[model samples]
Target chain A: MTHRSVFVVSGGTGITAEAIGNSMLSQFGDVAFTQHSLTYIRTEDDCRQAVARIQAAAEQDGTRPVVFSTLVNPTHRELLNQSGALVLDLFGTFLQPLEAELGVRSSQKVGYSHAVRDPSAYRVRIDAVHFALDNDDGGRTHHYDKADIILIGVSRSGKTPTSLYLALQFGLYAANYPLTEEDFDDLRLPEALQPYRDKLFALVIDPERLTVIRQERMAGSRYASLQQCEQETRTFAAIIGRYNVPSINVTERSIEEISTRILAQTGLQRRIR
Target chain B: MTHRSVFVVSGGTGITAEAIGNSMLSQFGDVAFTQHSLTYIRTEDDCRQAVARIQAAAEQDGTRPVVFSTLVNPTHRELLNQSGALVLDLFGTFLQPLEAELGVRSSQKVGYSHAVRDPSAYRVRIDAVHFALDNDDGGRTHHYDKADIILIGVSRSGKTPTSLYLALQFGLYAANYPLTEEDFDDLRLPEALQPYRDKLFALVIDPERLTVIRQERMAGSRYASLQQCEQETRTFAAIIGRYNVPSINVTERSIEEISTRILAQTGLQRRIR
Candidate 1:
């Protein structure tokens, strides 16, 4: 129950710091965390000013702050090392050995991870994103041929977001289809999705959670009713079972876990590095 | 141009490899990159086998492979270091120095970054993704009160994908509204969005690109015509300027660039680390 302050500091966009912080959170459980990016650290004064703020915060808390940093520059990293916080220098720890192993110097550039210098990879991601949107909720089922994976699920069962996540993160063409009342009544896969059977994945959620999610969208309607949710989920489960659809119960899973599981299950290649 | 093979090897999911590869791509431009994940290397044989594969690949190409790795285990890393390829051990370079700075040892467990051990952060991301989908293209304008930022643009101008990317990557509750013909004719902000003017951001695209994109969706129609695309884009630009809304021309930019710029412009806090 002890309180602690965690600061994720970076010389760039702080994505590395955020990622490391996420890992730390997963390992250590919950802690109050803040993110700071030293994106404009041009001079020694700027680096010192940034460090001073971390020092002041550590002093106020009466505990050494835990700072996760990915500052690529040596001068900026040195300034952070002078702070009262316990610094985890991501780039400093990794770059030299990397340089030696590669027999070439590391670029040591800031904001390189999410930089848009490579238009081709960037374009791949954008196209995938557009594909996800175009095919969301069975909107454009004819494009299933283009999709790497087609996620089928009842309404509000985590299909849309998971599809988008797969698209954006991995540049996978993910299309999602909602199992409607007609499909459930017949207990069959939709005709359009039949040809792409191998490309199909299913997402299921707890009926209770599904109801709650639907209620947020449409309060007091049959679509949001617990009875309808239970029936739809039961029918959807049968449909997935009949078709041998690779499925995940999303009630307790994150989109990362869902997408990773989908990729692993389907043995699909991510288009981007 | 010399053709070189790039390998991303990791004891966990090869996210570090993907990230570093992205940076390398930005700095070094294009190369043939491959990802090989050594997820569960529990023995010497596992390490040796992985290393041999890399050596074989390097030999085939007549060039030492540039390997970006996040292998946490010492024994496994040593095995890879012996390979003929140029190996960059991401964790090896960083962990010890981080351990010294923090006065503690890292767990050195693999798959730490995308691990679903922290349900709170996972839930936050899921909720944000759902929010983004729920409010997409003004589908549910009432929820604008809850949105961190509402992206407004003409149809097919990269609004939907950007909104979802913001949500998925940063857990920012982004809502997008497609400025329709009715709004354009009036030459004013949509009545529903006026109260949230400060939260408004805009996306503009090249009319030619818009026509091509729309043609893919619905060809040989007014919606896909170059003249219509130009007119809608022109009106949207005027509306954005009239409102003094922060906007980005997505003609030459990628989704990563678009989302990053949105975050920078809005100063919105990402719910995730």
Candidate 2:
């Protein structure tokens, strides 16, 4: 595999640059690349310093480094463009067109770049995150009425992480409940969840995967056994079928995929903007 | 006060499209935009359907909607190009240049678009999320030995959310410890956290903002009073000063900004790649 040095440069958090760079690089599974970030580069002096670093890196490696950037300042961008590297200045490529389409001059100031962000949306994230933590893993059933969606699954079925992702990323009030052995006694929906049956989103995972995950958590308990994993998932399916709750198998999906699927299936509008 | 409809269309999750669109649109602070996501769009048919939706939206609104997309297929890109909208197809803008730079034909496959993603990176995220939650809110100091960084702050000073974001987004093992009144009684670091002194990163917030956050949580209690907020923050400063630990004022910062600053200040490498 050919090795390359990749750098993400930006004026603010560099999240936008980092996100796009990583997303694009994932396509080249055969390439071996090391990534670095130059975040919070604000002044023209900062841009000059970053370009010097990039130039040094390119010379040291004897191969042009790949630089992904989102610099709003044209002067700063011109300096970076002249650097001895393959600079993909994303803002340089799209800003003029966006300015034309909107029929307004961009402030040209550095952006506080973030994913799904604004002051109001920031508030929503904090509130949702607190809600998710407070109501995590069936810790408190008293607050389900306020939850946008409730994730239910057997223990180690990717509930807690999904709940936090939905809350912290998209600003949704998400709560998760782990279905345990006690719930498998009758394979019936728990009484506390009956009132909010319509708000439930189930996560179904491969029994083998669940067993492996449990083993990592508790070494050699019955919970880590394949028999218990199968039993819990079987009971989980029965309960979901009995109630006809919307669900998806998360065997090979990432947390982002699971949350996006839930958003699509449940028709929940993400309050990100 | 112009109102614009913004649609993020992608062959995959549309997360990158949405992120770039939102980040750019935020620069035009005067215009109002309602954001929509067309996620998991994989087929030519999906592209045609999405263009129709965007065109119909333009017709209904009298002004053309802005469509940001990342379609991998040329045929699909051609169809979307004809849509009566400001079609800022991001992939079309950068792919050719990226392909030329790499000396390799780009795979042009529909991306698994995520902020930071891959199967191995996905495992890191899950383990880190679990670790963060397990050690949240000073719940279990037993696992301090494994934490990559420990976030210490007064209650409701943005510790937990930053810890969760660091884990979920950056694959860092972060644990948050909330400082309390009892810790302030003797004006010393807690015995539990004493051994991990060098690993601590303090969050110092404005007392007024801290009071407001506490008021929202407790409602009309001394814990939510500005006096107590001042006392706690003062004590927090004294502790960090005494230990010569690094810290940030998180009152005006978002979780992403806090995490990014932490990464920069602590020289911590994010394992997202």
Candidate 3:
């Protein structure tokens, strides 16, 4: 492989950029990727000092550095310019679009308002990016075909979370797909996926449950109406039937029960070992 | 406030599906969500019987039930047909795509694998759907305007995980965005985001440290090289200077340091009471 330059995503408190960068990093394990957050550089001089450190590293290594960052203001941007690294300005990029979409000025500090990543799932500590890439199967498509089991459902049907659990715990390469209105209209499988008929597994839920889910987003929107939800649920059921799709009604099932039952039915192994 | 149905996702060994389902249920504070796993239904007859119960509930409530499930084979799909609930087929959707992309079939019993949502990041339990949504900032631009801080950086810079930590730990509404190549080329803030500059903050990382990170995926891909990585870092630094962006480098800082530093720099109130 050719010698690659260092790509630095600057701007502290940038969790989303961190995630995307982590995701991208997952694709090329060979690249040496490091992330730093400039948390308290307030003045131009402070920025200049920071820039000196960055420039020193680049010059010492003779490697070009690429920086990804969000700045507090225009002067901060200028200070970073002296560092001589390629910069991706997230603030500038989203400033206009975010303003237009929200009808308000950008509050770049939004990330500081919330603290949601919980470390309770596993006894061991894992960083967010490491955990996501370690758990993500976005590029692992073949694993789906080899899966002894499969999950299906509409949005919020619990496919993603469940799949992660299986992969993390039982070593299952579980994959999920959403059933959209378009699929219901044709009442058929996407032509692209017609081959896995025998291996296909379906997840079914009650319309009442779906309506409750939609209510969370738009409590009283026409889309969340009981009648509309009911119709959609019924249509989904009918579509599954028309295709002779095999499925399981998960209305009252627990994760363990579902996995066990599916494994037993298919005569597949329960664990890797 | 319409009568809504509840769809529960469950399956797989090690309680991955169940854990995910638990997360999904937690998202809705006011809804009756029930979980059932295949463990309870051992035979085809048992599956048929379970479907009947679901159907009965739907009929009583005048709503169709939604099912999110992971099953070992298509047989359960047939059994679920006995129930009137609508079905979503995850296996069918993801299996082929994965197979095509990875050139490796999913393991017969690979464990849960939703990697994007770092279950370990938050204090509460979350499922796959929850993980996906956690990354989705509300569509409103003003959403971040009301935010205490915005996180900016490249992928895997610990954005999603950090943001989630802030949200769960403090109830802060955190939103994050990815910085793309296009953003770097343009250098100027995305016109839409021009208004939020005042509240903006940046995250920075050291080039050497970043190289350490990129090495995990491909070890030596050009994209992951220190030289290439350094160039990116310099570019980012320069852009921040040009735009006068306020930023921080997270090269050697812990999450606490980075998070606390951001809070101080932005002068935002801590979420904890």
Q: Which candidate's DockQ is highest?
A: 2
Looking at model 1 chain B, which ten-residue stretch has the lowest summed lDDT?
Answer: B24-33
Best by lDDT: 2
User: On lDDT, who's better, 1 or 2?
Assistant: 2
Candidate 3 structure quality by residue, lDDT tens digits, B134-224: 4433233555566555666655455554454444333355555545456678676655456766655566777787777667656888867
Per-residue accuracy of model 2 over B213-245 as CA lDDT, tens digit each: 888778999999999999999998998898887
A-chain TM-score of every model:
0.88, 0.94, 0.45
Stronger candidate by TM-score (1 vs 3): 1
lDDT at A267, model 2: 95
TM-score (2 decimals) of chain A in model 3: 0.45
Q: Chain B TM-score in candidate 2, rounded to 2 decimals?
A: 0.95
Candidate 2's TM-score: 0.95
Give all TM-scores, in the order shown.
Answer: 0.77, 0.95, 0.39
Docking class of 3: incorrect
For candidate 1, the per-residue lDDT at A22 reads 60
The local lDDT score (0 to 100) that residue B42 gets in candidate 3 is: 41
True contacts kept of 2: 0.52
lDDT of 1 by residue, B1-273 (tens): 445566666654455455655554444333344545544355678778878878887888777877776666777888889897777665676566545544555565554543243556666677888788789889999988899999999987878878887877777899999899999888999999999999999998889988987887789999999999999999998999988999888887767667866776677777764
Each prediction's Cα lDDT score?
Answer: 0.75, 0.85, 0.51
CA lDDT for candidate 2: 0.85
| lDDT per residue (tens digit) for residues A1-273 in model 3 | 323343333344444333333333333433444444444455777677767767766786576455555454667877776577755554454344323422445443322211122223221222322333333333233444555445556655545555544433334546666666666776777553466666556677777876776776689997777787777677768866776667766555444345555565666543321
